[model samples]
Target: MSSFDYNSSMIKAAFFDLDETLINAEHAHKAATEKAFAVFGYDYSEERKKSPNHISMGKRVYDNLKARRDGAGISEEQMPMDKLLDIREGYFLSFMKDEIVLLEGAREILEVMKRKHIITAIVSSGTKKYVELVMDIFKLRNDIHFIITGDDVERGKPDPECYLKAYDQALNELKDLHNQECIVFEDTESGITAGKKAGMRVVYIPTSTSVPPINYLPDYTIGSLLSFKTEVLI
Candidate 1:
């Protein structure tokens, strides 16, 4: 929930982080990775996902996973990168198709944002295909303004490339938009850091699975988007 002053601000655009911010991406990613590995008779491990923590992802899921797994010294279980990607993405979409669930108050807040006409977009380190699939599953294909996936950026979160690109896109979509007039909602430290580096205020809403590292703070932190009124910007 949010409570603040109003009537003296300019917040024209709002950017969101997809995974763990709006939807249950952690669960879906885990499910997909598990299925992808099982398809090749390998097991998914937490160590398999640790190598790319600080880097932004700009590759397809297979390449992304391959690199990380190789870096982790577990590349022996790999299959063709393209095939791995197809399998991962297929299972991911299929797994999430029936189980995709929005965070508390997610739709309500989006509806409010829509009614007010504030330009909204998704700035995520996730792949374009996967993000689109998740949006489709959640029935949010047209609910937001746009989505800037890792595929759209040369660099990813913590590098500011994705969020900065998102900011530029939002500006293009909304004339007279300023950096300060944009706010980012994120659930991870890297995402919050990226938003700040992009010169936009950030709201941190931590998810159960991806907790923010200690001391990683944002302009604001709310339990849910429900009480976050647009007027609070003023």
Candidate 2:
């Protein structure tokens, strides 16, 4: 991890990534992706989603799919990209409805943030529909004030556009919330870089499949979100 110390008092707002950071979406995504593949009439494997090459390919699922499809010459006429995604999201939502895998200490951490009166936001690469479903599934509609989804920005993670946009919004709504005063809780390398590039401190939580390389780590790293003790930041 980076050898940087943040003044706990400097933090005014915290932005969080949605998927692997807050909840375990791997299992749910597996079921949904498989069903989604059938709609595209392609033989699917869980490996397609977990492979390092694919995982690092795009910051958004649709972008990832488009890259893979375009590379394979799978035209929109054949797959109907937009419709395919709609189906995938539908299946994903349906699968998520039956069983939810909340990450360790997610609820407690969220409650703590709320109690501290720290402004919170969801800065995710997921679509609005997907983010909304997860918020509903976790009963977290009111936990965060702003939600910046994939659709909200033209560029994706590692681009800093999303987090920068978030920073601009935070400034409007929060007192004394400058760039350095903001914190980002993220899981992916792209997300970590994006937060840093946006000039905010980051607390990196690594999922089993998305651990970042040590040389380019965030300000802080923890094995699990539960391990992120709030006292340090308080």
- lDDT (0 to 1) per candidate: 0.72, 0.77
* Candidate 2 Cα errors over 4 Å, as ranges: 1-9, 46-51, 54-58, 71-73, 214-216, 232-234
State which candidate has the highest TM-score. Answer: 2
Worst 10 residues of 2 by lDDT: 49-58
Candidate 1, 174: how far from true, in Å?
A: 2.7
Q: Please give each candidate's TM-score.
A: 0.82, 0.87
Residue pairs whose backbone atoms clash in candidate 1: none
Q: Pick the lDDT winner.
A: 2
In the order shown, the candidates' Cα RMSDs to the true structure are: 3.5, 2.7
Q: By how many angstroms RMSD does model 2 differ from the true structure?
A: 2.7
In model 1, state the lDDT of residue 75.
Answer: 54
What's the CA RMSD of model 1 in angstroms?
3.5
